[model samples]
Target: MRTLRRSTRGRIGRIDSRDAKTGIGAAELPALAGGRIERVSVAREQDSVASRFAERIREEEELRLSPLAARSYPAVRVRPEEDCALRTPFQRDRDRIVHCKAFRRLTHKTQVFVAPRGDHYRTRLTHTLEVTTISRTVARALALNEDLVEAIGLGHDLGHPPFGHIGEEVLDSCLKERFGEDFRHYEQSLRIVDELERDGMGLNLTEPVRDGIVRHSSRAPLPETLEGRIVRVIDRVAYINHDIDDAVRAGLLREEELPREPIEVLGSSGSARIDSLVHDMVEHSATAGDIVQGPRAGPAMAALRDFMFEHVYLGPAVRAEHAKISSVIRRLFEHYVEHPEQLPRDLAGGDGTAAEDVASRVTDYLAGMTDRYCIRRYTELQVPQAFAR
Candidate 1:
């Protein structure tokens, strides 16, 4: 067997004298035996880079964070099996979320418009990215744990169903009617990382990350961390602006038709509105020692949100399509409830004794579907096609 030697200056001395004749001196030879000089140099450079990155994380924790910032040291949930020398706990959470299957599914899920044909319309994935960008800006300004805020923002909508809020509403009503339970995307998002991801092995995320994902929705309870609170407010800031942009693009609403009072306070354009909200949040939150918006900007933002709900979200322009999608969701749920065996083995009850388990399994499977997949499956099951068509 060949002996393995680590790269070192001393090892270069072992090069053959013939190497000297080739204008390769001992000092110029590769330090690692049986490896190219470039390989050894690259390996050393990678090691140095990794070391500097780890050191930078530590220094950032010490020098950059404020007293109110959540520290990555002493993580709330320690997983000895998944510890990383190069990344802090929150950073690891962010990485895991970005790599998960659920996160990928967000690309195909509806954001506002159902199965919108326009390439520019925001999907669930784009919406999550916007939330993350806005949240990080606020987090960094406050000297908070941006990694934690990013993980939460990236994961906040991981459990959203295929047809936007209409899909969610259908699922909620179906669950309540069939099983005396409710379906909330926030709770489902928590369920995903904790139990459903990684083929049931789960992401095993830290407590703060999990808390932020479950509490990012305004309807949910406020999260315990400042990072979580930052994401919570930023979620509103992101969706309100982007949904308006999407509505205008869809020809459902005109930019000029937007309510004037809120526009005067927030800003005329989407970018200006986002800038105003973020700046106001940072200024107010820094002064208050907590995440908040200025007195003026807060109410103005709320009015903008209310305007979107009335004119775009619940508008007549999309009502017919929304009802059709809601009907599809209802029909799909009923079919699964009647035929649990059609579900994947992991989701279908093996013994079929517990109705609740069957309902839950069906719900899990349905919630994870993408918009196209849901529609395709609905067509296959509900619509009968003529032979050889």
Candidate 2:
């Protein structure tokens, strides 16, 4: 087949069939010399097919989706670029979040258990996938943007520190003590996408995706879009249910010990509870024109969340490791703060930058570690040379 003279993106300039056979390599030819070339066209047939798929998605979204749903096309980004021939903007954002380094690090990060003996215990990555899946289900049912919801869900927890919430607490404490600034994982998540990932170039994610990620935590403000709101609520849904399963598996809690009222209202099993919550969300959100839970499921899920906090999250079994985890985090924080040079060059602010900036960078460095990596770093710092190696 003949090749057309085109740019890197496969956009061909005006050229004739005879010129197409020449296969312009490094050789520079006359620019449509004397207008011998005809009008421009696609060099590859697949490009047109891929563009049609993207266009079709936009058209379907417009026709089928609810008016409240966030549209995938015409997505807003901090840096504008050409749309993908094969993907909607939200789909591209999802792919970017899925493929980034922060996403990969989540696999080794903690969800609930610091280091469980059982392999089936959920890691941060698993928790993220669960949240994304559940959010997508809710989005689809409500005629909200599934791709947008999915992007938000997948990227929401990308900034969680090692060792789960405990890591977050310790980091927060460290920051408040030294810099008088709070360290919330949700904010850090925004920071990750806005300034940390891509070596400070950021993910360049859409505004909706970024907004959803930073607001997924209940402590933060609600997200702007209904799709973002779905992820925010479903984040709790995913964690509260899955964490219970993990707690039971770890022998930290028993099935019978669960609060009887909430258990009966939601369900006996994890799957049942999730199903109930998803249904409630879809039903209420469809009517409310916003993501919300039904009266029974909302209070019931809240009750279960409260129960987990009291019995499992802040309970003795999990708290037993708090001291050790705190020590590791504090020592690491101190080490990095004292030796800001140890942080990545980008994080380690240049000379004349405020001391608080250095401390903040140290927090970023520590917050990005995995459980085993954090422990290893602590051991390497504290242990004797003969024993450390």
Candidate 3:
């Protein structure tokens, strides 16, 4: 008979791991990455696909503590090889993203405020941090991959043009009509890494992180993992409440303007609204098995999201600004696609290929424009800035 050590991690439930280096109790499970769920069904109870999914989830969590092969792959990363490097491949990607110039520039970009003329409002940098904050918390709590989640959160905004979505819409409409709907931020993000970053380092992020970021968009998306789902929700959570705050600051929205029902459901203060949202999302994803509207606070949160879109996102003043910026971007696209030489060097010339290929190269050049650059280009082309003689 084998002598079994007493179970320190009571939650394993005869799962048997006296050899298990990391004893995982229920408390440990909740707190693993930052309060993520990490339980799998007992090995003998594999009766259905749903159970298998849960088991697979549990296995992933277990992988974090497990030691890799006897040797390390140094070319694969910048960090040194260690027995249990807390920083995984995905984590390296996160650090690289943080160090990148584009990530740092987010501080000057807008979240809601146009000029952001103040320091306190949510800039793109603050928004990214907020998303990271919520994404890590949810990923840790669900026992999903925190490194991948954080990476997704970090990479999610990499493709954002200057002045927030206003810049994107501007570029999209401008480039799309003539370029045949070829410009979108997600694909551009993929481009930044493939062709743009540091003469093409592209960050070389892992597959899961790429998938999460590609599908994070709301419209016409692709399949993704649990980490991606968390990112999708985090994007919404960061924008919805923050937009309301910005609108209020810009005097477009008033505390009194909130519809009574949404106000009750979302709470008054931004922090309270965020708390309600995060708690609701965690509860829903745990119980309903997805973040879609369902029992356990899902419906209320959905209502609040919708109320935000109606009262805040689509409000008239913002739409007018979106239109104005969109026009500027479109004009630039028309001008550049015709005079491709005027574009930046890397963007102007590509291997001979499809006409849209040329347009794509042009779009690549144009999309990278800073808000100031785009405005300057508009001035050069329209105003004849070549010195009045």
- lDDT agreement with native, every candidate: 0.83, 0.86, 0.65
Residue 289 of candidate 2: its Cα lDDT?
72
Best by lDDT: 2
Q: 261, model 3: CA deviation in Å?
A: 1.3
Q: Which residue pairs in model 2 clash with each other? A: none
Q: Compared with the true structure, what per-residue lDDT tens digits does model 3 show for residues 223-329?
A: 35677878887788778878778878878778887766766876887788888878777776665555543353455556766876676566676676776677677
**Which candidate tops TM-score?**
2
Candidate 1 lDDT by residue in tens digits, 1-389: 11223233212123344343355433333544456443335556446555565556767688989889887865666344545756888888899999999999999998889867689999999999999988998888888988888899999989898888888888999999999999999999998898888777788899989998998888988899999999899888988999999998999989889889889998999999999999999998897988988889999999998988888778887676887988788888999888887888764234363788878888898899999899888888876765312
For model 2, state the Cα shift of residue 378 in Å: 0.5
Candidate 3 structure lDDT = 0.65
Better of 2 and 3 by lDDT: 2
lDDT value, candidate 2, whole model? 0.86
Question: Which model, 1 or 2, shows the larger lDDT?
Answer: 2
Which digits, one per residue and each the tens of the lDDT, describe model 2 over residues 268-340? 9999999999988888877887788888999999999999999888888789989999999999998878877
Worst 10 residues of 2 by lDDT: 24-33
